[model samples]
Target: MPLATSLAIFQSCKIIGVPKSTRCAILRDMAKVRKAERRPPLNKTHKLKRQDWAKKYLKTDFSKVLWTDEMRVSLDGPDGWARGWIGKGQGAPVRLRRQQDGGGVLVWAGIIKDELVGPFQVEDGVELNSQSYCQFLEDTFFKQWYRKKSASFQKNMIFMQDNAPTHASKYSTAWLARKGIKEEKLMTWPPCSPDLNPIENLWSIIKCEIYKEGKQYTSLNSVWEAVVANVGFKKLVETLDKRYDFPSRNHFSRVCLPALYDECRQGVLKDLANVKYFATTTDLWSSQTMEPNMSLTVHFIDADFNMETRCLQTSYFPEDHTGQNIAAGLRQAIAAWNLDEGKLICMTTDNARNVTLAAQLNGWMRLQCFGHRLHLAIGKLDMIYGCNY
Candidate 1:
């Protein structure tokens, strides 16, 4: 029984609670007993075995080996996020939401000696069936990587890939045989494994490099631009050059396994500044206000003053319908991106009080749209002349 229960019974016996002498006696007796249990320790052990299989496989010479894989490129926002704080008060810790915009992506790739062959964007709705995979091999990967090599290299080349259903299917195997690709040349991939492929590392490096630049894309055009700008053939070749000599048998355990684990840790510490930064013209559209939808565009100029339109964002007017409210929305968007107030050099918009006021607040030199200006100019000339011309 609990000491509190015993104390309660003792107190019930008396009108003014238990006597001091009785309370002291109960406390003294309780102090003599002990409670609580200890738990036993757990033991764990891990062992690794490096195989000689890769050396035996390479005994036939590396000229016979070709590596292949696929990579997915998103047409919308890439599946990633920026780490930041959120919530309020004690015990209300911030959470990291994995940012992803629902959009289609393409996947196709291959590898050769210290070289990456194809990151060909797959056509939309094309499933990764045996026929599609074979088409990529014959048309894209072969034309891009194999045909360019010496005839001797082609005769001896062996393609390697994972046991993806498409790669292992009977139709794909038959296609390879018809193309003079030997079965022995296909590297035997272990089940449930990704560590054996170095292309995995290449993909990670590309994503990390892309994110490091602070770039975001909501449309397919922007996504393609970002992907093209980041992963050129030259960079892929360079990556392969550095890591190709790594042991094949222990490829996953030795290189990819450790690299992948490290990438996870790096991801936790990565930030928005890691994404590539670009400037572009942005047009804002909204229907809920009196102020006509405002459109403002900003351009980024390098040190050489070579200008390119980059960052684009939309601003909507709220119920206030005043110039102040419109200006406030634009300011909030600018502040969210952490752009320098003084560096914003230009603004282009239709002639409107809210638009002009917003530009003035930001100290930007305003340029009226020439097309709109031309229309107004032509209208005034016709009115003054009083002619149908």
Candidate 2:
């Protein structure tokens, strides 16, 4: 039963002391919340086919194999879900499902030998028919990886994809034949078995990363960017696994960290080049360990007039929190980014003497944050009112 029902029962018995949290705790000790597992529908024939395919590939070498698939990401949250919390052993809530027509993008990608193939964004409104699928294969495979490998390598390599209509079409088969991809080299995938495909796991990881923390994209372009970023990060992790046997924490900090930072810094600088003016905000804070840190964030209106914000840097400041040192640290950050001082607008910060002095030292106008002022005002009111409010 739902927690509300239990709460109502307790209320009717005049057990007001048992709050919602207590009820939830009592429920948790007896039951668990679990989402239903999703699986493709499979009949007896499909199950037999899967078993046969599994037996056939039990001893096959998968090191030289490539897996490919296309996935669609929706602007709406992941696969539509509707449910009311119920106790364990209760009948599952019926899912409210609907056909996804628009507001999503389809992307085709592959993974082979610790390397990522094309995260090719399929054109909107275009169906993935036989001819287009063949074209995609030709472009991503033959034109790139296949062309670069030796005859022996190509001969031993296997191409694997799901049994979608386009994959089994006559045109696609003829195209593969022309490319000298024999039946022995083309893996015959079983129906209703996505668990066997490693690329599906990769896709799941990418999706989880993309939609982590309930992230929602406002634009398809942002979705594409996220896809690319997550895919690229996956490739990087794969490369790290392949090259480094056992890299230490210091190794990553000394080597990989700088490379990633430089790449991001360059990208930010390229975007900033077009902007004539931008505002910045800085704040000083301490970690749980009380280690001092300062962060700077840049805000600018892009070409589309959309207000874009970027965290320029968060730097450790072990030095004294004097105005001169703060000013020097800000100057150092500005110099590192190669930002033009003349293009700088006003700086925004809380009413901190050191921060204001730092702005003065940098010869920039400062804007006091109204949010901080309000917070201070509220604190004073609470002090004056005691428990009355």
Candidate 3:
């Protein structure tokens, strides 16, 4: 019989003021009562098998492979529990609210071998779907690691990533295959296991450096600046493998030594071509003075050759309505650099009527800004009458 039912019967019988010897007889009988069904024994063996496998996997080449993953950093306070003491009698202490001075921005980034790829802006409401994943893989990740001449340093290397839905999708898998990335080359770490990746250690180091400078940030720009300035590639690499120390007398000494040796081998070979020069892109914004302003920046590379970026000259609508004024700034910059108009490549800009007309007149190729294209796509979706594509 269940313990609760037996205890209830005992209590009811006691209320009747039964004799002590009779009550003792009932209690003794209740002690021998048992349930009709039996349960399976606890599976200690299965747990032990899993642990053994984990230990073996940790000692293999899987651990030597560099793992990469993305994390989002918010300008707002962290999610989940607040740390502090609670009084003995207090009815669930109130969470201390942290005041945030500025709004937040979404940062999308991937890391491998103590190297970070980006903290690219993923504007609010933009979903991180397969398409975005592909874009990031092609436009940012592969571009930064393989396309540039400087990144020639990464030849014949393997990259390890998680089995995220997008990463495992058919399209992404095919893309990787086309790019000469091998599935077998990728090290498969156990699912739901983050403790093994050293990048997590790097993140802690990044946060420490950010706070060490004693700077307070209130805006998204300030937060981005602080994060960028603090977490460079060198600092991330310095913290890797710092937690492990193997004794020479250990049975597993040789097994662990190979992983450490591999790291040293890669560290000694540096790519002197400088990858930083090709990873930047240019952006041009309008000024309040009704005059166009242009800034040159690097974006990405292709086939180890740096792909130059060109921003369209901003067009201003004045009472004069003359093309000469708009073209003057661009012409001056080109002449100063001694560049010929025939050598000009792709031009990216907003779909201003004047700018389109100007590009057509100059015989230069123009691509509408991708941000503008996304905005237009969203607008079109809202106006889809019925089955229009």
lDDT score of model 3? Answer: 0.53
What does candidate 3's lDDT look like per residue over 1-389, in tens digits? 35444446667656656666676687786475554564333267745654764775554543335456665554543443133456788766444344542345555565545345565556555667777777767776677645662434444355666667877678877777777666555554444445556667656655555544233445566566556555443355445434423233243347666677566535422231233322212234556555645553323343467564433223343323234443454455444433445555656666766656655666667777899888888778878854344
lDDT by residue (44-98, candidate 2, tens digit) is 9999999999898889888888888999986544853222367888986443233
CA lDDT, every prediction?
0.59, 0.80, 0.53
Highest TM-score: which candidate? 2
Is 2 or 3 the stronger prediction by TM-score?
A: 2
Q: Which model, 2 or 3, shows the larger lDDT?
A: 2
Worst 10 residues of 3 by lDDT: 272-281
Candidate 1 structure quality by residue, lDDT tens digits, 249-283: 36756987789867753542232232233332334
Q: For candidate 2, what is the lDDT?
A: 0.80
User: Order the candidates by lDDT, highest first — what do you get?
Assistant: 2, 1, 3
Backbone N/Cα/C clashes per model? 19, 0, 4
Better of 1 and 3 by lDDT: 1
